[model samples]
Target: MNDHAPRRANRIALMIGHCAGMIDLVALPVWVGTLITRYGLAPQQAGLLATLFLGGAVCASLFWAPRFQRIAPERVAGWGFGIAGIAFAAMTQTSDYGAMAALHALAGLAAGSALSVTHGTIGSGEQPHRSFAMAGLALAVFGIFILGGTPVLVERAGGPALFKVFAAVMIVAALTSVAAFPRRQGATEQGQRSTAHIDSTVWYAAVGISCMGLVQAMMFSFVERIGADRGFGVAAVTGVLVALGIVNLAPAPLAALLERRWPARYVVLAGPVVQATLALIISHSSEFAPYAGATAAYAAVMIFTHTFAFGLIARLDPGGRALSATPAMLMIGAAIGPVLGGTLVQHAGYTSLGNATLAIATVAVCCFARAGRTRAVLSEA
Candidate 1:
């Protein structure tokens, strides 16, 4: 195989696919907000609708990952993008909240499939790290879309039209992926045949990833609430989130450097520990400087932690496409975290929610530390 063949086309397709996946999420919060206004649903009910979307993703991922392994990765990814687009397009015609929720769930399912298939393809490639780096770059780009694009789209086109646009984007991405990705022989024909066993090491990585996801969900969902509690305006709250995203862009390079010297586990563990500390500080302080600093630290920690977890998982299961399983598990955790954290904030306030996040981060650090040590010893042997 020409390992050094032009991956630009494939990488671009992958980026587009990921962006399509991300656009679904970008559309969701605003869509939910619109539903609330249109239907006058209770806050909890609205939240449940959002949860259903993520819950469907979590449920589908369990089945989707294995199926992707059974099918050609490229085909699975293309179909995923296509399905997502179709689902989003369907959303434009729905007025019933129930129908909308189901459509969102379908979109989530498609996104989950796309995520697994695309990541598996990248992992199966020759230079996996570069592929991962490209994935990260895609994530960063989509992060910008999530942060800035959704609101603008909602304002200009309204929710239904916005979803239609998102659907069109997914369709384009699916076509590109189908054209760009290499054709694989067959599912059973490629990779090692290992039983679908969840090893302790993988579980540890999952837990770590879940914790990181929880922290991220809390930050994204509640940062504005926390800032408002501290007497900051909406713009100030947005600034904190924007700053976090900007600062987060730095950790990919930092993680690459750290991977050369330190084991992935150590770096992973350290990220959560730092994040927990920052969470504590953010919880206690209302000052603008301190809040900004805490947000930046939290952002850096999250990026490094995720980078380490993904890298470690990829390294540990290099023989097969098992790394695809990690994203599904991670997405499940991500789905749960926001719902749980949002509930906590509603009842107990931002301080309590922050404390809860810190506690989760602490547990993650311990789990990752143990796993890191074990991995190091195994590597040495």
Candidate 2:
């Protein structure tokens, strides 16, 4: 009982840290407008800041995460969160665009380290699918909480003051890492050696994830406008979004249950196909009900696919190095998707937008399927 108690506490702590890091990333866009107005910076400058942060995160995940097997994940995660919190706190003192951008990148690097360690731990666990599902649940709950309160927080506290809260959250994440990460089995770092080889499938998985991200983001970034174009009012669109949030919460658990009963390969393969079909349905439908239904279905499939993919990568490479790249690939895909969607919408309209995303999703689905086949061939040989 005593041994089990610590392990359980560690899991909870790790989940909290993961949730905190995700909140920080997702909440930044809410503050971009504030940064522009407060600093007298151009829109491009604000965008550049975000880009730098993401770039830092991707770099850290690539360069730092692989070393986690040697260094204790607990220590790595704790220091990362601690330093990131300090950087964010310093950000509150700066109004200079250059200074803020640099600090934000620093924070991003630290946050990425935390994320890499957390993901590594989760993905390499006994039940990777269920672990990821729990993560999705945590993210869904945190997202709902923040989305509900963000407007009020900004209005009452003003935008800049929220940085302090972000800083506090990072500190809490750091503290929680103590319980969440594995304790060192040996006193010497040299004793903690890892011998796992990097699998070729990792790169394929990264490509597949990027393609999925592109399709999902393209649709999501312009969803509100798409509804507006179809004659839906702001209220109706928002109502759908709210309903979609509720809908998104269910799939994680369902996927977790499915993981227990079905093969992971089938679960992963089905996601993109279902999402592509949903995109097609949305494309043909003009009515609010159909659009809303398609949107909700897409949300569910997206989560299911992501959870499966992340788990698959971790299971492929137990060292967690491969999973580290997941966030970077997803971000890269999402960053580019909106530009493509915007251009397509201008030239070809919503139907083309759907078709374009569907086409990309098709490629993504094929990538995963091919990867699966390749894995099977290698196993047989």
Candidate 3:
């Protein structure tokens, strides 16, 4: 095989992994209610199951990332996907809540292992930002398919059947992973080098990532209520959601095109400002058309910010050490968002929630600006 073959393979692996990871994560929202209904569990307990799954994934990703050099990434990812497929399928065999949670946790760990491999592939690429954007685009396309097909599947065969679907997808992903993700020598070499100090750029990116998670989750978690409070009916709210999902697909390609002409930093900096502005508009708008427009803008900008941040991290640290911890930051921020946002909405109101999101967005913008400036100065020096 040609030397360039591995790079091409790695790109394919990343695309598959991104799609699989998105399906695994997004499936939770559809199943959370089903878990409560079928298992006769309390709402809190059902939520805890989902949380435990995410917690396990984050911990596994963190633990396995540093060790990728020792263990071949392809091996790790292939086996991880196989194991996850088995675990997901096993969930259908048990009705016990404990067993379900345990199985889901195992799935999470395997999923994380697979995810680390894909991320490392992207981070080590020549054009990491472009690779990340492509990955995002792949996920968005897959998400649209899922959104269209899942409701029909659920109606025909209930929620647990979705596990079987995920399992089949995982199995397919596992089969291709070995060919798609060859080991990269640069990653192994970089992993062996000693590191003593932290980069300020990494911190700025981390905080921005955390803020992205926080505001996105907070807004999404209560989007329906925001619409309802504005006196929109169920059909109108559903239309707005559908519109947002469809519109969200545009950003990755747009960002890819824009980044080729303008600095990627501009895209990163613009995202938060755009999202904050849209949040304020959505919160204040009572008209359906205005609300839909603002929501769509928020979704598009949200994708840009997240993809840019992850791509930036990869470009800064190709060894994938810092990039490995990003998912944890996101999980932590997302886990906190609902609780804090709920409290603010309860006591203060939606206006307070909007203000809080704006504050976070401002901080993210400042961090991105500083990080970009620091990079410029270092390059000049």
Q: Tens-digit lDDT track for model 1 on 63-135? A: 7555555577677778888898898899888778779778878877877777777766666556565556555
Best by TM-score: 1
lDDT of each: 0.64, 0.67, 0.67
lDDT of 3 by residue, 278-297 (tens): 87777677788877788756
On a 0 to 1 TM-score scale, where does candidate 3 land against the true structure? Answer: 0.80
Instruction: Look at candidate 2 and give me any clashing residue pairs.
Output: 10-179
lDDT of 3: 0.67
Candidate 3 shows a clash count of: 0
| Ranking of all predicted structures according to TM-score, beginning with the best and ending with the worst | 1, 3, 2
Candidate 2 per-residue C-alpha lDDT over 83-194 given as tens digits, one digit per residue, 9 for 90 to 100? 8889889988877777888997898788777877777666545566687788777766665555345535655766566677778878988988865565645422222223
Candidate 2: where are CA atoms >4 Å away? Answer: 1-6, 24-49, 87-100, 155-158, 161-165, 186-194, 221-239, 276-291, 294-298, 335-355, 374-381
Better of 1 and 2 by TM-score: 1
